[model samples]
Target: MTDEDRYELLGEIGRGAGGVIYRARDRDLGRDVAFKLLRREGSTLDARVRFVAEAQIPAQLEHPNIIPIHDVGRTRDGSLFYVMKLVQGQTLKEHLNGRTSRSELLFAMLQVARGIAFAHHRGVIHRDLKPSNVMIGLFGEVLILDWGLARPTRGLSTARDEHGGTMTLDGDVLGSLGYMAPEQARGEVHRQGPPTDVHAFGGVLYELLTGRPPRHSRTLGELIPRLNELPEPAPGPLGALASRCLAPEPGARPQSGEELLALLERVT
Candidate 1:
């Protein structure tokens, strides 16, 4: 068989800002896999750096809730790509196409928190955690999918973080604007830490409860002001939890993913 024939691309299953995913079969392994490739050929330095960086993060992480990457390499045509398990269900965004009850929302957020906790313990931070980055299995498994925006938190960021994960050097930002933490939005990359992810996690929880991002704002200019004085969320304890997570100051927020998850349990 030809080198290009190793994987039989079935069809395009999903597409996003990062890349396009295809449902394919590993002919030699006799199994199905989700193969992802950048939408462009990654010819530029930024694209090439991201192509390798994204694959390395997931490959290094080992968690039940994190998607496992099987292989990463260049295609016969020299385009970069990676292979991962094909989750049967849809993203948290798609799963929430209809209204969700408080209990169900809390349950999913708990799983998301737990996954982030696992990553945090390992010194990795998911700089971009959102509903679209989460995958729910047919049997109710929650898997954190993309690690493209993840990075080590022990030191000041370097060129890669600035270009790939952090706000761009020129003031452009990263991640979903509606879910971005204030520090991320302000381009204060040095201030990001575990709480940064916690802030995004809170934003996710807010969306889970209210069906929109915190304050329903979709742009950085709109989100930053509201971050300092977020409108009160739903009528009870979960509302309090959301507020704590979205605290404008990183230090004021829940210190870790585990701390946030614990608070969620106590409140709910």
Candidate 2:
């Protein structure tokens, strides 16, 4: 069957700054799948490279909690496209809209921690861990979405744009503002190691527990200092652990994602 005959293009599922995701079905496979079509219409060389990087990353990583790559292909006009198992669930952000029991939320985040820890062990830093990137399915399965920003840190320098912020060189910010670490926002290449993911994870947990990030600064300058000075609102040992993870100094944060996962499991 042809493109039109093989898959019916259902409406978009989510729109990110980098790509537009659609809910489509595979006629051959007889199942629903999500297609992330790269927006390369007016992209520069660097942007195209990053888009290809995103496609390769997910294809490489195979984990139960991570969305499974079904297929990677291109359109007749040359747009980059890839398919993944269409997750049936709401984003963690959506799940937090109403009141829910604390036990239920902790259980949900625990799965996220496990997934991140697993990915970190494989030398993949999510770089973009936020509520919207987490999908909670009906059977309590958590799927980490969009490995688009994941970078292999073997020797390649942290990518950046002209403005000195973390970017793909084509000048698009890879992650969302509210969830990005201070160093990531400054375009400081040296400071964007795995610990940056730890900091973002802390922000996600903070938002889950308290309904807001620990630091609410509207700008990068405003956010960095507040990370050190202000105390997190999360109660008990979890609050202390989160504070350590969100420390302004990257070295002061957890040494690895596994360490942070251990702390979270110990607390809840």
Q: Which has the greatest TM-score?
A: 1
Name the lDDT value of residue 112 in candidate 1: 85
Give TM per candidate: 0.88, 0.86
- After superposition, the stretches of candidate 1 with alpha carbons farther than 4 Å from their true spots are 1-4, 39-42, 99-101, 154-172
- The digit string of per-residue lDDT tens for model 1 on 50-111 reads 65667777667778888988877667777778889899987888766755566665677778
- Model 2, 86-147: lDDT tens per residue? 88878888887756567877788888887778777877777888888888898878888877
Per-residue error (Å), model 2, residue 125: 1.0
Candidate 2, residue 150: Cα displacement in angstroms equals 1.4
Backbone clash total for model 2 is: 2
Screening candidate 2 with a backbone cut-off below 3 angstroms (N, C-alpha, C), the clashing residue pairs are 164-187, 165-187
Error of 2 at 72 (Å): 1.3
